[model samples]
Target: MGRKNISDQRRGEIIISFYEVSRSLGLENASIAKLAQHMGISKGLVLHYFKNREELLLGLNEYILEQHLRVMVSEDIGKMDCKEHVIHFIENLFTRAWNTYFDDGVFYSCYALVYRVPEFKESFKAYLIQLHEVLYKKLEEAVAFDVIVATDLKELTEVIFALIDGAYYYLGMYNEHDLAYKQQIAIYVKYSLRLLDFRS
Candidate 1:
């Protein structure tokens, strides 16, 4: 949104409205008018703060990343042993992504828009880089503590992340029960453990 000195509460409300509207109606169909309608406010109000749909989307994307980071940072991972940290990381990755349709839907929607909207590519890439950094650091810590043997930390992080991403996509596509979706997570976790030379 605009760099105007808006109240944090108000800005948060606007970001959530954008998220809800985009989730309900695909991002392609979400407009300032639609968001205003969803928020029970006037479009002029939204425009006054955001200036444009792109700005609103950018703000919402940042909000999404902030929310994810809060969840990750809130974890007491530092207190856990290397092996427990690895398990928690894997479990948190899958569970967090599967929590809601809006979360993943808006996520991939922003991802899709990155190709056509050049302005968004950097933000999306930065988000991915942050996630990669988190995973890479965790893997390095695991290797340092001899919890796992990974000759190439970067490559191992990519492999583990790719498996989770693939499983997350597949689970989102089906209407199966959450238990079934979690079974998919278990499978990915099993494969990741074996690949990382760690036994669960």
Candidate 2:
């Protein structure tokens, strides 16, 4: 692997290929050789853009975060009603697309690495904090519009994130066929709405 400049498109291709290979091969087992082969690029080229596995993983994490924001938060926050915005946030978190976007194995591998690697720990922690901030902002908007009556923004933000994370983890552990999965998600959504004191 030599130092060479790569186009942003090439870098994105490598990141995506890394994700595809890692998902199939398991992140720990997915070697740079496999990633290079998957992308049909030379190993040196992969290294040219990402100096090492740690750098690649961090880049992948950033890519995942950006993709999530694009897909899950497409609507302008100021344009939607408070209730609609709140529902949007919940639906995106529990949706099948969300599961696909963060494939169970790859997502958990990243999660586990956060605890073991100090550098990854900070990057992953920042990602979670950003997620909380986004949710908190939406909740604040909801309160302003009287969508949830009155609420404690900080406490409610923690509760909401916990509920979503718990349900997502539960569903991942017991991933079933589409029908059963949908049923479970429906139940989760209902319960989450109840927590927000949300009414039709």
Candidate 3:
């Protein structure tokens, strides 16, 4: 049991190093040998954990999902009530907070793999579905607490994520300081609040 735990920890460490390297270098350039050097370990050791770049990317997809959860949802949202939670949730999704956790280039590179490999496609879908599930739960809570109206929670969750996906992809082209970036956030938030029937 102890050995299994250690193995999982080691595998997670290697995946994190892979994410960092992929951020600096392109994902295609982030090879296993490169990850080994980045960790100051050996290629053979890295291989022991990840058989190849394909498997390592599968691990990276999991890492991206974990980071997205941190950005999109929260446990108690740092003691915030449901209303504060809704606003923070919306603002965080549109802001640069994700930059602190994962790189856009590294993330999208992994996303592109969804088109190439079946297993990779499933992992990527898991990433999206995981986010959707958590957000749906949060929306349910907001309705329970009267923070939002009791509409079709599932449908509203889907619409919100669709808006979020579109906002991020388009806003990625603009600098965070650009007026266009701020405007997009405002525009999306306004409609999202309307959907939730948010008064504040």
Instruction: Report, for every candidate in turn, its global Cα lDDT versus the true structure.
Output: 0.76, 0.77, 0.85
Error of 3 at 174 (Å): 0.7
**Compared with the true structure, what per-residue lDDT tens digits does model 2 show for residues 118-150?**
998898888888888877777766776778766
List model 1 lDDT by residue over 1-200, tens digit each.
45444556677899898898888888788999989999899999888778899988888878777776655554555632467777777766666544543477788888898888887888877887787787788777777777877578899889888887787788777555677776877787777877776633
Ranking by lDDT: 3, 2, 1
Q: Looking at model 1, which ten-residue stretch has the lowest summed lDDT? A: 72-81
Q: Which candidate model has the greater lDDT, 1 or 2?
A: 2
Question: What are the C-alpha RMSDs, in order, of all predicted structures?
Answer: 3.4, 3.8, 1.8
Q: For model 3, what is the C-alpha lDDT against the true structure?
A: 0.85
User: What shift in Å separates residue 181 of candidate 3 from its native position after superposition?
Assistant: 1.4
lDDT value, residue 131 of candidate 2: 81
Error of 1 at 33 (Å): 1.5
Q: For candidate 3, lDDT tens digit of each residue in 1-200?
A: 99999999999999999999999899999988889899999999999998888999999999988998987765536422468778877777777888888899998898888889999999888789989998888777777777777788899989999998988888899899988889988998888777886534
- Relative to the unseen true structure, what is the Cα RMSD of model 2? 3.8
What value of lDDT does candidate 2 attain over all alpha carbons? Answer: 0.77
Which sequence of candidate numbers ranks them by TM-score, best first? 3, 2, 1
